[model samples]
Target: MWQKSPNHQSLSEEEESKALKKAPSLRFRFILAGVLVIGIIASLAINLIFDYSQKLADLSYDRLLRSALLQMDENVGLIRNEVSIDIPWSAFATLAQAEEDRVFYKVESLEQGFITGYQDLNSFPPNPPVLDQIQFYDQMFSGEMVRFAWVQRYITDPETAQTVRIILGQTRLSREEMAAAVTQKAVEVVVLIALVAITLIIIGSHLVLRPLHRIERALEERVMGDLTPIDINTPKETHHLKVAINHFMARLQANLEQLENYTADAAHQLRTPLASLRALAENARDIGYSNSASPEKQHQALESIVQQCDTLSQTVTLLLNQAVVSHRLQTHRLELMDLLVPITASCREQALTALRQGVHLSLECELKESLILGDSFSIQQMMQNLIENAVRYSQQDQDAPAEVIVQVMEFDLFYRIKVIDYGEGIPESEKERVFERFYRGRYDVAGTGVGLSMVRDIVNHHSARVNILNTEPKGTTFQVDFAKHRFDGDNQ
Candidate 1:
């Protein structure tokens, strides 16, 4: 016969208690979300600023080119004559040098052809001729892309009836350079705006999140088991969440108070009945007429009284344990292995009794020695109750070989303990009620109805879980799962 090894890594009650204390609160997540939203908005604003600045630079460059074209048009008449034009280059030079020095001027007549300064410098005629006003064109000049502004003026020679079209055009390198400079300056301004926007976002986010931080600090300073409403003066944006949290805390505080009262009241009520039954049993044993009254009858009465007393005692114990488990469930660390050993030991006597009644009792432990953080005592009590219930419900008739099987296995993040009995299984309808306190099945059996309920309370205390499955071939199985615990020592 192989002795099953206990789950060594099971969390003790103390460990399960510690875990509930470490869960993060909602306010911390809220602050992180707010910061993320601000960061996204800042990024979008920076892109928009850069785009708007580029548009402004293009508009300003077009305006400057038009103004330079108008100045050349006003001076064209003074420099043009039929067949013998004496164009003073100084007038175009003055206009070119005034605003942008990278300008190149040219004068052309259909009859005279290219006949002025900068005309041989790769100049091209403007498209969509400007009859009386300036037209802007982008063209390649001297192997360099340039913007040009030009106008064509038709002048009739007063003495000769011949018409001369004077074309005046200026290369726009200076305008292009000024536009580039303006665009650079706009980029610097947009960068400064983006920096300022980011700074404002950071500062505003901090101010907005300040109230949440206050609420968080208030919650952090609170003592364990303290479910007081958080007192915080917050913006309207946060009021709904604050109110919801406060309401939940208020209800929790009330529930805890009621549970405390129930435990105290139940303990006080059950103690006197147990004491009286013990006293009556003691007196019956001391009375000297035992053989005269029939020893068997006397013994039977005494045994009945003792059994009732035990039932009462167990009830009170279960209730008190439930109270303690509930409190610890609010804050506890649990180890599954630590819980299994004691539960198995506690149920050994019960198992042996079942075996004597022709029922086989076998427990198979297959879980790895995994650690968990939880309420060990509650976990053990849960296991004890489950195993005891299985044994109690198992059929003892010799015709059918009744059996109770307990198995422990591990899955990801949970340690599973299953207690299976081959007896009259629970009906589907009664399965849910089995875990309710003081609820018993209609089957005729001696039970206080608190065992399964106590098991549930213990499982809940560690924030663990439980399930019941109706096994095939007329039997029932109870499965309890405690949260898995990792071993840090080996890694260290």
Candidate 2:
């Protein structure tokens, strides 16, 4: 049960401690999920930012085209009853700042042919725009994509009413260059945001799971049997877990203390009887070889020796049973123990003892359900102790049989094993103390006081109940409730 771990075979104390500290520090899965979710969100944000930057750059470039086209609008005026136009360099200078864009302009008549400017400019479709309205569109010009702005002048000439149309177009080299610059900056910002987001996520995840490492370190640093409570300086999210760990350690400490005390008490209680037995046997030997000693004296000494021997045997047996029960309960290791096996075996072993003592022993198991969970040896010891105790304490009736009835009955959740003896029942005041280790009750019976105590320990180990109640005719009955084991049809 206490075997070392296979991995620990090659590890020093410091190395094993380090290994324990490393395992519970951080979980990779949580960190991975956090990074993944943040990456997806950052990607979406970067896409939105990139698209917005492109639109902004395009809006700025479109305004430049509009400024150049407005300059052309001023060139229109009627002269000598004919439409006149003036071309200005300032009109094209704002768009020409890029030094790579090809700017073109055209002025024509709705009723007449071309008036001035670029003669090959494509005609602007649709009706003239509303007063002071300017229309902008994209078109392929001279085998290159161009941006155009169109304006119409509705002026009544002195001789005739006429509408004039003016259109301006520019190549896209400058606008595309501006958009590329904006896109480059936007991409740099997106990359920086991704790096910052991932870094924060890693840091935050480590901080959140740091308490788990604290708990692991706390457990690792403790020496053997150091079931101390953990510190409570923990995060609010993990406060409950820390408290639960402390509570578990407290329970463990208390149980270990109990086991330690039981060992001390057993050693103290057994030493006196063993010493007396040794002395009595030596006295019996001395009397047996004495020439002047009488037969009755030697016989009395022999009887004393036998009595002391029985007491020692009973004490040692009960002590061993207590230890076994304690070990099983501590380890929580048990198997399917048939209830009928112990009930039948204990009665068989105590039958002769009971008969010689004028106590009748009987078994009445009418219940079909008898399976239970416990160490078989511990269960058997408890049964024998209860039976022998009944035989010793039962008041002998001169005219009637002083019998001990072992009855087994079934209930919804448990099986009740009642060992009833028509003896002087225990008083109400001492009922609770009867189960104390080495508690010698008011009975003058020739037996060890540990039998009932061992019985109680075994009962607790199996998580069963033992009730001491009075019989109908002023006697005692020890009724033990053993929980039925959960078994399938195959096991049965």
Candidate 3:
């Protein structure tokens, strides 16, 4: 028993991965998106870092204010039972050590009322038992945004205990100066880094994309019919692309050869018909007046010439169609379309011709909604050739009418189209050769003998199969199976 190979089914991702690994990689030029993303992220990071640095500088200065306020906390005490106090000069010295900043202090005793300091500076409430707690906030002092710190302490006289809050506030000249200096430094560093990144992106982009530019120039400077494989050895990333281009050039060369053969064949095949037409024409022109039937003979000669011309035109058309099918097999794209739409239209178009030949042509489909993916023109060409062959070859007899049936049937995993003709059936031995170009059956029928050949090419290009089967006892059937042709990405 013959068995099909298991590897003929769908592709595995592992195989695709291996194939991609073997092929030359086409790397993306990351200069554009990479630079944009990096620039945005770096800008945000620099701003965050600089802003945090400013807050950190202000926080360190807040510690200084807390220190001076602690000193005031220790200074407030009940002396001689009068709840008196003296301000420390060193505390003021610490607060006064600012570049272009004015400092203020206030000391208030909960029991001693005011201890000879700015009383309005005690406007903010301290956060509970400020024994070891130092609170900082922003406030308005002398019509400017000032940073303030609050502290509280308890002092005992061995008999009476009293508590007071020490609050100190300062104008924000020193903190502003610190923030400006740090941000300026940060800006300079960011600018430098940006310049370095931009330079690297420029140089890297030129280095990476240089191979593509070279390939472009090679294509541009190429002469006519120059399909030589490009020898680009640098930039390993574009290696696969170069190889693909070379393969395409080779295919193009083959197509050009096919076209040349088509032209040569066309000229060679028309020679016999054209020579016969010319001989008949010359004979008609020289038909002597010695016979009374010369006029009738001339008319018959003109009719024969017409028939030969039709045969030549059909031969040329089929050859042209064959060439087009060959070219499209390489470069055509598959499209999603309805199979019934074009099928019905083609049958309608050929109905009159079939009628003229004493043939009854009809179409039938098992499914009403049939979807197929293919190139419409190529599929149409294949269908037209098959059905027209059936129409032309259907047996005409005195006993019964000639009939050609076109049927589309749905199977488990594929679609089948059969063009069945109740004609003198094709013999089993000659069936295979009928698809070869310019090869006809043993019967002396008028045909260009290239229709079935073009059909074979079209079917193979679509990855489908066509089989010839002897139908019943006296007819022939051409069956084509259009299997599922799915790309890997389309499934995903």
Per-candidate TM vs. native?
Answer: 0.48, 0.65, 0.78
What is the C-alpha lDDT profile of model 3 across 399-429, one tens digit per residue? 4348888899987668888988887778888
- For model 3 the TM-score comes to 0.78
Q: What lDDT tens digits, residue by residue, belong to model 1 across residues 130-214?
A: 5665665677766656666666667555653332344334445555555566657755665676567656765776777788888
* Per-residue lDDT of model 2, residues 1-492, tens digit only: 134676675566668788887775445777788678877887787778678766776688778878877777777777766777787788777887768989887888876769987898875646656756888777888889887888887767668766888888888788788777777787787778778877887787788888988888888777776776786488888899989988988878877787788788788768888888889889988988899999999989989988887887887777777677777667767787778887888999999899998888999987654778877777788889899888877744444458999998888778999999877678998899899876877645666577788788788877989999998776788989988886577467
Question: Superposing all C-alpha atoms, what RMSD in Å does each candidate have to the true structure?
Answer: 13.1, 7.5, 10.8
Q: In model 1, which regions exceed 4 Å deviation? A: 1-84, 96-103, 109-127, 153-173, 176-206, 216-228, 287-293, 306-492
CA lDDT for candidate 1: 0.66
Pick by lDDT: 1 or 2, better one: 2
Worst 10 residues of 1 by lDDT: 160-169
lDDT agreement with native, every candidate: 0.66, 0.80, 0.78
- C-alpha RMSD in Å of predicted model 3 compared with the true structure: 10.8
